[model samples]
Target: MKRREAREKAIQTLFQLENTELSVDEAITYITEEPTNSFYELLVRGTVQNQEAIDNTLTGSLENWSLDRLPKIERTVLRLAVFELLYNEDVPDRVVLNEAIELCKTFGDEKSGRFVNGVLSKLTKK
Candidate 1:
């Protein structure tokens, strides 16, 4: 899969994991098609394994918005993006941010992209 397709799949899988009783392993199995991409696997596993820290990192960056108050789609998108930002050193910061915003735009509500951008911009500065 293309990296963008993998990222989008990660977001969808992450969304499922967040909203359901599914464990990370189950979510990964549930989402992966045959010939799974390595990056997609890394994203879901890394994001789930580091969820608390990731959420806490974003909690401070969000302006006037608590983590729980954000819609699940937005929260999941942020989690996946922040995981990449923190863990994937090879990926450029601008690419991570732009891709996250694009995912938010495509999968989240109307304001999700801007909200994601604002939060990410602050977090990246730190």
Candidate 2:
């Protein structure tokens, strides 16, 4: 799958994992019709593996928002975006930020794009 598709799927996987007790394998199946790719595995597993650090990073970047205060979709979108921004060094920061905002817009509320962009812009500046 393309990186974009994988990223979206990874967000879905994270959402599924967050909402249910399903294992990562099960969550992967929950989101995808195609077989999961390396990027998909990388994002989902890496995010899970590094969740504490990622959440800490987000908490610091957020102006007044706590991690738990974010809507579920927005929260999951942030998780995916932060993982890519921190770990996927080969992808351009602009691409990661744009893809994340696009993902939030696609899967989250109307305000999701701007909210994600604002938070991620702070993270990007670091």
lDDT of 2 by residue, 10-126 (tens): 888898899899998888887886777888899999999999999999999998889998999988988888988888898898998899888987898679999999999999899
lDDT of 1 by residue, 20-54 (tens): 99987787778875667899888888999999999
Query: How far in Å is the alpha carbon of 122 misplaced in model 1?
Result: 0.8
What's the TM-score of every candidate structure? 0.94, 0.95
Q: Score residue 60 of candidate 1 by CA lDDT.
A: 86
Lowest summed lDDT window (length 10), candidate 1: 27-36
- Flag regions of model 2 displaced more than 4 Å: none
- lDDT for model 2: 0.89
